[model samples]
Structures are given as structure tokens and as C-alpha cells.
Target: MKFTGSIMITCVKATELIEKRQIQSLTLGERFKLRLHNSMCVACRAYQRQSKTIEKAISRWMHITNNTTHHLSQEKKDKIIEELKKL
Candidate 1:
């Protein structure tokens, strides 16, 4: 879907497009619209930058959490079991 230079999108639509682009590929029209909007709108550009930062942080957190391992020591496990039995 090619858009002529005449079409204009609102900031809300542009931000939604930014988010959608994160999850999936966007059509050329959508990409063009977003870039055009971002170039003209300061708030939308800031929002897009913030969104990208948040996505990067979340991805880093997920990677760290997935790779790390946690374990309870035998003493702690035994104590917890004994306490449960008393209850």
C-alpha cells in the first residue's frame, strides 16, 4: 500500500505504529507514515525513543532471569519442611 505524500497520520496513530513495529513487520505505508509523523512531531519522537529504551531493558531483564539459577540449601529446605510439619 503506497501512500502519496498527501496523507497525514495523528500522533496516536504514529505511536501505535511504533509499538506494532516492535512486535511485527510494518507495511511500507505504515513505516512511511510513522517516519513522517516522527519527523514532524517532537512528542511522538520522544515516545518512540522511550518505548525503544523500555523494550531493551525488558529484553535484558528477561535474558538475565532466564539464564540465572537459584537453589535452596539442604539446611534451609529441611528447616522449612520441619516448620510446615509443626503447622
Candidate 2:
């Protein structure tokens, strides 16, 4: 679907909305913004798909970590924390 220029949502806003949906379900503005964006841009549609995949991977990783073990070597913890801080 083609959008009139007045209707196109910006990529940054679209990405924010997509991430919000991953964390929880979409808010009204997020839902509208994503729908508008996906309708207009193939790149945004691909971004939404990739975002969902990453969210799922994170959730699965967290679940596995919780089930397996909470303990880590101090060095491992420090390394992981450092990498996360970089992000």
C-alpha cells in the first residue's frame, strides 16, 4: 500500500513502536505508527520481522538461563556485564 507523504511514519518512530510491541503488546499510537510504516516501506517490514526474531531469541535465552543456572564465574559475569554496557 502506498502512503501519501503526509501519512508516512519515520523509521525511528516505527522502530520504537516495533520494540514496544516486542516487550508487550502495542499501545494505540504504536499500533497505528507501525501499521502506517509497514504499509509504506518494505525495509520497515523487514525491520519489524528482524526485531521480532531478536526479541524471541532474547526471551528464549533468558528462559534457558533461568532454568539452567543463575550462578556465573566472577570473570564471566564481569565480561558479560562489560559487553552489555557497551551496548
Candidate 3:
């Protein structure tokens, strides 16, 4: 379905979109709308960037932890915890 230009997605829905890239491959029309909406909506843009950062961090953590059954190195674990603390 085509998005009507009149309505912007809600914050929760925009977050979902950020996490899933649900509309990353937007049609040209949708892309234009998103750009306009994001430019005007600081909250939505912040939510999107924060959520995307979380998604990437989770992926990286998974990759690091999945490499072996052995416990994660203490240094690595401490670094991760430190970074999370900053968040």
C-alpha cells in the first residue's frame, strides 16, 4: 500500500522500522516523505539513530560471543560492560 503524504509514522512504528529496516528500501515517494519527516522530527530521528546503534551493537556482541563455547575473555567482557555503561 502507498503511504499518504499527510500522515507520518508514529515513534513506536518508526522504531520498528529502524530495527527491522522495514522500509529501508522505500519507494521514491516514501523516501521523500521519510526524509521530510525525519528532518522535522528530532525525536523520531534520535530514536531511529539510537535504535540502529543498539541493533548494530547487539549484532556485534552476538558475533563475538558466538565464536566459541569458551567464556568470553575478561578484557572483552569489561570493555563491553564499560561501553554499555556509557549508554
Each candidate structure's TM-score, on Cα atoms with residue i matched to residue i, is: 0.60, 0.50, 0.51
lDDT of 3: 0.70
> Candidate 2 lDDT, tens digit per residue, 28-49?
6557667877898898889978
Ordered from best to worst TM-score, the candidate numbers read: 1, 3, 2
Model 1, 1-87: lDDT tens per residue? 657655599887899999999899998888888888888999998998899899899988877745446677899999999999999
Go through the candidates in order and give each one's C-alpha lDDT.
0.87, 0.77, 0.70
Candidate 1, position 19, lDDT: 92
Show pairs that collide, candidate 2.
Answer: none
Which candidate number maximizes lDDT?
1
Candidate 1 Cα outliers beyond 4 Å, as residue runs: 1-6, 60-87
How far out, in Å, is residue 57 in model 3? 1.8
The RMSD of every model to the true structure, in order and in angstroms, is: 6.2, 11.1, 13.4
**Please, what are the lDDT tens digits per residue for candidate 3 over residues 1-87?**
466655576666555555556445656655665667787889989887777788789888877746557887999999999999999
